[model samples]
Target: MADTVADLLIDRLIDWGVDTVFGLPGDGINGLFESLRRRQDRIKLVQVRHEEAAALAACGYAKFTRRLGVCLATSGPGGLHLVNGLYDAKSDGQPVLAITGHTYHDLIGTRYQQDVDLERVLGDVAAYSERVMSASHVCNVVDEAVKTAIARRTVAHITVPKDIQDWPSSGPRSKANVARHSGDLYADAMPLPPQSALQKAADLLNSGSRVAILAGRGCLTARKELLAVAEKLGAPIVKALLGKAVVPDDHPLTTGGIGLLGTAPSQEVLEGCDRLLIAGSSFPYLEFYPRPNQARAVQIDLDPSRIGLRYPVEIGLTGHCWDVLRGLLPLIEDKSDRSFLTQAQQRMAQWNELMETRATRNDLPMKPQVVARTLNEFLQDDAVICCDTGTVTTWAARHILIRGAMEFSASGTLATMGNGLAYSIGAAVAFPGRQVVCFAGDGGLTMLMGELATIAKYRLPVKVIVIKNNQLGMIKWEQLAFEGNPQYGVQLQPIDFAGVARACGVPGWHLADPRLARGVLKEAFDQPGPALVEAEVDPNEPPLPGKLTTDQAWQFVKALAKGQPDRWDIIRTVVENKIREVV
Candidate 1:
């Protein structure tokens, strides 16, 4: 049924239900591209501007769809460019397959053009890496790569030499006796914890009155189970950033996000609770969690290594979130005392009030919080929000309320800067009818600005809101907060992002006035095609944590005393923003 090794590989991918692939073609991968061209009706390649975006788009597609994402690239630098995005996939535990080309078989060891050893280069980021040595090896290698990626929830790589890709697809020699593989592999069934382990976890959760639940990305599909457990325990749900959409913010028991970009209510509950249940989250900040001896904890995770990673747990149950929660629900007793849940809800209300006050502030350069809040007001009920890493993350985490069927994600563990636009592209392609929005900082947007052309060419209805602060806002604050140092080398030159978007054949708007934000955002979202909005926000605004530590306070003072730029403005802005909460 196949003509060549490349054709066989493509056919196998199609058999696995892969309809879309993100890639950029080059000479090294011409053989594979030719096969793709011939099989155009079976599968479609979504050409991207850069190979890095291709990989990131694949990661995004996987995160949103819960399916295997595939990306392709040529040899040498093209393959090297995929490393950052592949690491993003690896760190975030997304299933992705990366296909790359290599130099001719004979010239690989020699210093031939584009003869870099990609297998070794991608070794650290990929869970499985292989190079097809023969035409008969292509099908087996591709099958293995796909199986490994999906089963392990990690990145997998396959490299095909240029000459090998064009060779005829042949069966193994009769005497050689090489094993053949099938393409019918599917995701493994959801695992359930042992009944004894589930009972122990349930007993621990039932014993405490002040129970708190920490949810993360793994809880995405287990929302119903998570809420049922929370209701039974009378617990408050504090979400990690990646799990923002697991439970709606409007839910009475939801205490909002945890850690630096988290909410005040989340901090209060985590600090004050007597018992904690971590469901499918490996939140890294130990300080944000309860003191080791203060609370008895139970953890449920799909990975055994992550069970007690962030907290000391009385019981560690290794299983899928949905399965474990279902197993534990029947054994759990409904908590009669509603005191803890009521207190958490009250705190969440006060936090919401404080956020409103901050968002309404009429600062001259426009507070980024205002931009995020305004965008939230205009977001579709089921919109997909992709945010970049920076101060933009703070605004999105704190202001954007994920409700209905909304989905949200970013470079959570990897914290990469340039993934917002590429992620939005992937979301747009995956669900063409849904509203997809990207919140990007000026620095992050500039890193992969070339993708605007890709969006325009596809005419996707994605809305890009660039928070134009003209600086690396997050790094600037981290310098002062973590190191007690003045900001240096963080400033960025202002650019007319809207102009660039227009040049790329997309509608664009530039808004500097806070009063015009809502109108401009509505216009941008109303556009049938992709659009960009450049909202100039204040650079001096600090992204304060949910609860300021004494050490962080001292660091802020030390940096100010050491001649931090805009010292007076920073002081004024911080005081103005926090004054109400303090009162």
Candidate 2:
């Protein structure tokens, strides 16, 4: 029933349940776009301002929907622009399919207009990368690319020559031996760990009186099982940033997030526990984990390679988080002494109090923490929250309370900037019925400011909150904390983001006074369509870690002594923040 190679490709994707695609249009991909135009009623294309936003939006779609997210781009520069987003998908283990156009077969090596080796250039980021050489190869290549991306939870790429896209659809050659593929592949069966392996993990968990459980993104669907296991062991739950919504922030046993943008309670629990159980998370920070050989550890992960990747474990169970946790539930015995859990709950309470005090501060220049906290108050129960990389990440991790069915994600492993708005756009496209919000820093928003027009074009009701601090807050702290040097090359020029949003036809608000934050945020969220709020926050407020090392303290002193421009202001704010905990 398909007329051309492009038509066949689109039909195959629709058969695989792909209802939407994120892309930018160009001449090289015009044939494919024409096919999309013809079948506009069946599949929709959410055109973006830049190819990079398209790819990032695809990554966001895959993260939120747990399905294959597809992105299309033209040849040469447009195709190359997808690399950064593809790397984000690869690093975070999300399923994404990237389709690119190539120069004509004869013009490939002649350096014709927009001539680039797309397949070769994309090889590093994709699990499967191939070029469609003929019309007969389109069906098989598209099928394989989708199947590989879904099964491996990684990026897959396909490059079709511009000329070949319009060729008449054809079957495999009849004269020679050839193979055909079908688009009805199913690869979502849940794998359970071997009974013996589960028993080993259970025995290790049961042996210790002081137990702590660390959960990650993989545990999103295993919340009930994770809580059951924790309750049985009287273990405190410590979540990684990606796993923020795995357990509610108000849960009694949860110690909040772990690592630099984490809580003191989580750090204490990991350090004091005699036994550790890591479920579905390969948290990369080794320093945040228990010291080597300090505790007997058991890890459960779908991928065997990631079982002991972060910490040494006595037993490793390879299986889906829900499957493995469900199996181990019956074997784990309940702890009679609730002392460890009690102490962790107490620390969590104190940490929450300290955080509340910080969030309530009415500083002359607004504190970023207050913005995140205020946004959290107005969030819908099931809001999908997207955060960018930088100081905004710290505030979101610390202040935003993930409750009900809310979902939170970012460029976790990639730690790339400029993805907040793109991810929010993808969320808005995928689920128009749900409330979507983005927390972006000044730098990250500046990187992808063009996407605001995309939001206006779609008229999606996404709330954009920009922490308008005129500096790269994260890099400034990193320079002082890690490099023991004063900040340099991190300052950013001030921009009226709200004014820019208004120019793009979205309702906008500028909030510089702390007293007007809640009211302005309410007005922005009340808008029926896309809206943005620019909160001008203080740049001197540092994003202090949960537990500061002595060397880091010495480095902070060194940087201050070396004459930072705002050293005195920074010291004053740090003392004021620290005083909240003691008082």
Candidate 3:
């Protein structure tokens, strides 16, 4: 077969060990699509309903596999649709490669059909963006794009003109491109910090009796070392949402997630600690962090700019999570005191008990917490779960316990809707053998409802659990949290997501009664292919934060006093639920 530009790029992708490509077929890239078809055996192109989903899938694939995920789209609007998902990957520091199509080379600035500048379009979201001028530049551009994405842990963009894609390849393939890097290629290898930095961290930790560790996604690979450092310091650990599963939820020292979607115990641990160790996380919520001078901090991260960006730090140790923690463990003194850990454990236990009570309630309108707990009961040790950003995030954070080898992913920084199903599809494609699940709110699920067809088409066994509250639950809560206002524009008509899933050729179940949740969820999980379970939940049940300030309390009371039909009933139910926490 003659070597076309598409052939060169496809061959390079194969050489880079990319076995799959998430993309959509469009008129702008008919030539590229033809080449994809020719090389279909080597690289499977996952056809998605929309270009946005394609980009999100690539992000999801990279997040789970720790490799450079690849996605393709046609010119103009197709490339434009990829911006949101690319931003999600870029914001969260995931490595991804985006290939977009453009018009013929001669029509570059003629105002022809689909002739937008691809470089400028993706410039903000991509660390490396380039256009293929000739067949000779194919290998170098594609190779460098992939390399830069891996080395910098960011997105790389390549736009190939429709005509150029059909040209024969004559580009040079460097030895660097052929040689594969061992271990984790997604993240650049970072060296340990200086001895003085490690010693300073150790000194601060030893001097403070109450030490706390805030672990994030960067600590994913350093679980053992992170735990070792925590144990040596006699500290309780608080997790950033992205780092929720860094250490299992049930770990004695763990207080679950901190900040808005966090537990009470995690807040207590943060407020009570005298020394804070931030490992591999740039948790953006400054209010959730301890005030300056209240607790001294030592931040360990690979990026120097990010070291003290999130919180005020006395010492910044720029290095990999494992390297910094491993180096500091030897220098740190083991603390004999256990009061801090003991108090944290007690508070966590109380919080856990309250959560269990709420989650186990077989109330008429099913509790969303129960949906997560029931799903958790049926999940495998190696299950991969993707959560949408909203109220469902709260349920997943508090109810789902990360145990064994489970992998949890979400839109951490971007926090976009319509990502749950797309992410699950990518995870399913990346690890077909592993069980995949998506926890989404009704609002989010409806936004990308078309992905159900993709799931069914591929026979990807992704179980979707939609928390059908018939409203934008998170936004509704936000209004109450920020100001005492009656809900507006947040109400959603109840949706039959299960029926929609069935229409897409995926089996589904709708659970209105909480009593049937366990059995129906199990049945859905047992299905050999894609399945969706929509559980109607209490819309008024607020997702309370770990701590409520005086102003927030006032806002809540004012919102109730505005006199909606069920305002008093909602207040009563909320008070009753709070009373259960103490009783």
lDDT of 1 at 242: 96
lDDT of 2: 0.92
Of candidates 3 and 2, the better by lDDT: 2
Please report how far candidate 2 places residue 323 from its true position, in Å.
0.9
Better of 1 and 3 by lDDT: 1
Tens-place lDDT per residue, model 1, 1-583, is 6888888889889988898899999888998899999988989899999999999999999999989999999999889999999999999999999999999999998999999999999998998999988767777788888999998999999999998888888745445535564556675767888898888888888999899999999999999999999999999999999999999988998999999999989999999999999988888878899987999999988888898899999899888899889889999999999899999999889889988988887768898989999998888889999999999999999999999999999998889999999999889999999999999999999999999999999998889999998999999999999889999999999899999999999899999899998899989988888999999999988898988899999998999999997999899988866685587
- Report lDDT (CA) for all predictions: 0.91, 0.92, 0.88
Kindly report which residue stretches of model 3 are placed more than 4 angstroms away from their true locations once superposed.
170-189, 563-566
Number of clashes found in candidate 1: 0
* Candidate 1 worst ten-residue window by lDDT: 172-181
Clashes of each: 0, 0, 0
Query: For residue 227, what is the lDDT in candidate 2?
Result: 97
